[model samples]
Target chain A: MLSFVGLGISGFESIPIEGLETISTADIVYLEQFTSPISESDLKKIQDSIKGEFKLAKRWLVEDGNEILEMSKEKNVVLLAYGDPYIATTHIELRARAIENKIKTHSIHASSSLTSMIGECGLHFYKIGRIATIMSEMKSLTTPYYVIYKNLIEGNHTVLLLEYNQDKKFFLDPKDALKGLLETEQGQTRNVITESNYVIIASRIGFKDQAIVCGKISSLKETDFGKPPHTIIIPGRLHFTESDALKLFGKCIDEPFDNSEKTEKISNQMMKKYVPMVREALEEIEPLYKNQKEFEIILDNAERYIKDAEIFLGEGRDENAILSIGYADGLVDALRLAKGLEFKM
Target chain B: MLSFVGLGISGFESIPIEGLETISTADIVYLEQFTSPISESDLKKIQDSIKGEFKLAKRWLVEDGNEILEMSKEKNVVLLAYGDPYIATTHIELRARAIENKIKTHSIHASSSLTSMIGECGLHFYKIGRIATIMSEMKSLTTPYYVIYKNLIEGNHTVLLLEYNQDKKFFLDPKDALKGLLETEQGQTRNVITESNYVIIASRIGFKDQAIVCGKISSLKETDFGKPPHTIIIPGRLHFTESDALKLFGKCIDEPFDNSEKTEKISNQMMKKYVPMVREALEEIEPLYKNQKEFEIILDNAERYIKDAEIFLGEGRDENAILSIGYADGLVDALRLAKGLEFKM
Candidate 1:
């Protein structure tokens, strides 16, 4: 049997009670630290507590799991990892392969930084949307940029996990990650990330030296967030209780504010521009062809559609609002083009 | 001083190593099981392990927090709860209050069922979107229904936490939750939930008899989920590995398929109907306005807008697509109305 166990977030001390016994009793235990680096003291403590043969597993060894599977066939083997073991797709795949090979597999789930950091930062976990990862080698940060945009418009917090390459002993710095996001805002221009946007940097969560610092991006520009394994949380809407909790729990360089307030949804952005523009265009063309029966009918439809558009927008039918405004704009523009007037669309 | 420790998903065996020491050495240990119920065996084990004064804390005690906060001012009080402590908003609020009172606070993060259940079901944790809770007393399930709809369109998994009323010993059954979603579909008509929709009911996770049963809602209608603390998972897109892992790790009543495939995005749904309808409308009125010079400009613009709408939709500019199509329809309709024909919108 092959057992997968999590070391949880706080290194040796956060491992589940059952996981301790599983590692001690196993014939062989392979500790994988590629997901997150472990401290020397915690590593020593984990080694001293285990009675089994201990081997450090690299990322490739866990991914290419022939030796682990072969050993588990005859002896009890345990593969331990940082955070919840199955959060890594490679671990889940390994478990599936073990089951297919007729080897019994067991999992011991432990605390993950993904879930832990939110609470440590005093943020509600339920409000977290789809998580995004920022790799240092990526050509562009558009994917994660839009992720934050979508989450913001929906009033959901976004958790950004930075790249950690264990082989290179490299961790993506939080400052660089923030800079990348700010740069992405230049191209996307969705008002998602700005200098004044509030962000929380959760550094070394679940550790004794864990620190959570929050402020606008500009204020945090000169701030130094010590240590590796940092996460950035861009909160959307904030309940009063949440803001209070954040103020009491973390180091605040500035008062907490909602980032979602600045980032408007695309449909709303369209409506904001077109609603007034379409109405003005209709007013401009109204007297030009007033007494003509067919043109008057077109003008009447344009005015009605403009009114309908505003109602749809207020009712949260954003797509319909945009569509209605566009139609009205089209009607007025068509008439202007036929009469050789200035184009409004 | 006060400490908040999570008992993790498993009962006594799953507490963090640090958490166990904190509870054992604390002056008072208040075990709150309102979030989830602990088994009798686990309860007995927990009581035996605590060397300090052990007290059972009800929901009110935790929510009120005055007693605990007062005790923490002078005594070492620990509030140990099932799953991760901060997952409950009440705990976060209490922590905030403790901080406001100048009481030192500590947290020992443990495994959350929120993250664990996703892995246990062989689903990717990052794919999880915003979570929704379904209460038995809710007047309508429309809120959760739309949440599922939004998550599905984004190809993200939805985790539906069932209502657990600890005082009444009442837990919303997984079957009832599923039925409620189906009923919600009748009014919402978003194709988010139906008899044919696939779902997974994770029952008593982290326990000995934990079962992850998944299939179509119709197939699971007669399934006896055995116990309370059940959670329903509505998976969006299924990666091949995810499907294979689910079939191997859980009881599969039917073949795993993408729930997202059946549920189209509202924008896409709009485009599907409007694009073709506008094209048909344009075709019918094209020849009638062919010779008329002023009306021909309108007809030409209509044709261009229709084509632009299709291109925009294909490019994933959904709002733009809808706008373009609506504009085309209005142009065609305006010309038809002038000629005493019918309306297409």
Candidate 2:
């Protein structure tokens, strides 16, 4: 039998009764070290609770082929993954390998940073898009940037997790992450992210001293959010309620520019130019489309228009491009009409 | 000051250490009953942990305007919610309300069903779509069909949470739910679901002795899954890895259907009749269209032809219809390329 157990987000106390039982009953216990690390104190607590010797598995043990599969045979083995068992692609592969060997597999789940802890910062879980992990030396990689760009195009909020070394003594802070993202955006000529935009900086989530600070990217450079295991969030479109939550719980008062004024100006400009185009697009397409066909067309056209508009904005033709896309959306009845389509953007 | 603390999934043990501290220190604690009900034993355990008194808040206190909000002004209030604090839309509103009144607000999040817990039954979380709650009296409502239909079309899994009523000792069981869903699908003229299809029935998830069974809906109808808090899952598209997992962990084992045999038969029957009329339509539109445009026209015509070809399959067409739809997903790439569009299915 192969069991995958989540040790909860913060510490040992967060694990549910079922998860504890699974860990205790296993013949051999292994912990995946990459996703989220359990502190020595927490590890000791789990050992005491389970009354078993816990072994740490490197990323290669789980990610490499056949090792875990071989271990699953002839033993009641358990793999302890931080957060939920299958949140990462690595664990998924592990489970797949175990199943192929006809091993009795179980996933004892607990709180994950993806959902439970992210909500503590007052962000809606449903509104979040694909999560991005920032590497310590991100210049060598395009994977993280690709995830962020795709998530932005989908108009879903992106959660940026900072990469930490094995010791947990060092981590990529939010300011450094913003700089890296800004540099990447500039390199790619993606204008979606800017210094004036508000980003949420959260530190020590699932802990008593957890801190959440919301401010412009420029202002965040000088502020210390405190501690490791921090994350940054780049928001896409904000709802009225989300905006209100930001104003209240986030450090919106310390913004570099008048956010309300900028928001109003942006809204006014969008309404003036884009709304009419969107209306025209809807009128032109509505007569010819129905059911799934209509939904597919609208989704396809909307994605194209949004992409074009982003390019136009990046090239400094903001007004014409914004209006043109707005008109296109209007023609498609884009004012939340595409909600049923579940298109990311 | 106002605090929203998530009580984690599966009773008292699932809560993080920070959440417990917040509840222990709060002058007034208000737990929302509607989202998730804590067992009496769990409540007693919590009371024993905390030095202060805990108050149970009815649904009215949460939904009613300004009641909880007003109380937060006079007291250091902590509002307890199930799973994560921001999973529900109401909690978002409450946080915003607290912020508006200048009351300092914080959240201590814990476990939520949104995690990879569903994988306990060997199902992937990413494969699941927008979750839909199944009410006890779904016979009178059209929602179940709509939600299931959407999930099926998108090739995503659906998690059907059985409704819990406070006044009555009634909870919807997986057996009744399967029957209800089968009836609803039949009534709507959708034939994707059948007695032979595999369904996962999970009960008392996150608790000790949590039961998970996977089998044909007909096979499961006779077995008692045991206890309250049961959920039913209908899987859409299965990856090779997922298929293996299901085969290993899932109770039902049957010979896998041959896709090639079904597809070839369906294609041959449809091609004999529908291809000629589609070709005729393509010929008429060829003169006015560009090369790329003409390709799109032909593809659209082909899709329309396939839809019409469904009439040939008749009642025996149910299984074939599902298989065909799954195969047409390959043509979806061609359709997108020809139409020069980008969209999620």
> Highest DockQ: which candidate?
1
Docking class of 2: incorrect
- Find the 10 residues in a row with the least total lDDT in model 1 chain B: B334-343
TM-score of chain A of 1: 0.99
Once model 1 is optimally superposed onto the true structure by TM-score, how far is the C-alpha of residue A141 displaced, in angstroms?
0.8
Per-residue C-alpha lDDT of model 1 across residues A1-345, encoded as one tens digit per residue: 999999999999999999999999999999999989999999999999889899999999999999999999999999999999989999999999999999999999999999888887788988999999999999999999988998999999999999999999999999999999999999878899999999999999998999999999999998889888999999999988889999999999999999999899889888888888888888888888879887788889899999999999998888888888888888788778778877676
True contacts kept of 1: 0.72
What interface RMSD does each of the candidate structures achieve? 1.3, 14.7
- The candidate scoring highest on TM-score is 1
- Give TM per candidate: 0.98, 0.61
DockQ for each numbered candidate:
0.75, 0.17
Q: What share of the true interface contacts does each candidate keep?
A: 0.72, 0.26
> On a 0 to 100 scale, what is the lDDT of residue B63 in model 1?
89
lDDT of each: 0.92, 0.62
Tens-place lDDT per residue, model 1, B1-345, is: 999999999999999999999998999999999999998998999888888898999999998999999999999999999998999999999999999999999999899999899999999988999999999999999889988988999999999999999999999999998889899999878899999999999999998899999999999988999988899999999999999999999999999999999899878888888888888988998888778788787888888998999899898788889889888888788777777787777
Instruction: Report the number of the highest-lDDT candidate.
Output: 1
